[model samples]
Target: MTRTTHDTHPVQGPEDVSGEATTSRWQQVRATGDAGLATAEYAVATVAAVGFAGLLIAILKSDEVRELLLGIIRGALSVG
Candidate 1:
């Protein structure tokens, strides 16, 4: 198989293509589907973060696991 210089590169650009339709950035941002989606995504993410934080606080405050880890770490760090 053989390749030519023309096949490897394109000289024409978007500006060279005339009369092609384009969408403005503000128009895309104003779409009905765009606005609500970000807020909905953010709400779900915020709820997950809060739930995870609550679970972590519960573990830190509990008696058995926290105490066990602390004792192990302290023993490993102890100097003779």
Candidate 2:
């Protein structure tokens, strides 16, 4: 048995309908990449701020919580 493939046309925009202009493919790719980078930067900043708030709450409420957090920081810095 043999299989057949079909070719499809891009969507017709206002200019395309009039046969006046066609869109570039590379521009679509660059726009998508830039949007992805912007979203990632926003996410990182949100997570760091939340972690700091958890540390602050522990400091205000529990001495044990404060000691555990201090140990985490000390471990990270290899200090007493």
In the range 1-80, model 1's lDDT, one tens digit per residue, is 22233533333445544433234323433553332348779899999999999999989889897899899999999996
What 10-residue stretch in candidate 1 is worst by lDDT? 1-10
Model 1 misplacement above 4 A: 1-37
Full-model lDDT for every candidate = 0.63, 0.59
**lDDT, candidate 2, 1-80, per-residue tens:** 22223222234444443323333434444554533347778899889999999988867688788788888888999955
| Candidate 2 Cα deviation (angstroms), residue 40 | 0.4
By TM-score, who's the top model here?
1
Best by the lDDT measure: 1
TM-score of each: 0.49, 0.34
Query: What TM-score does candidate 1 reach?
Result: 0.49
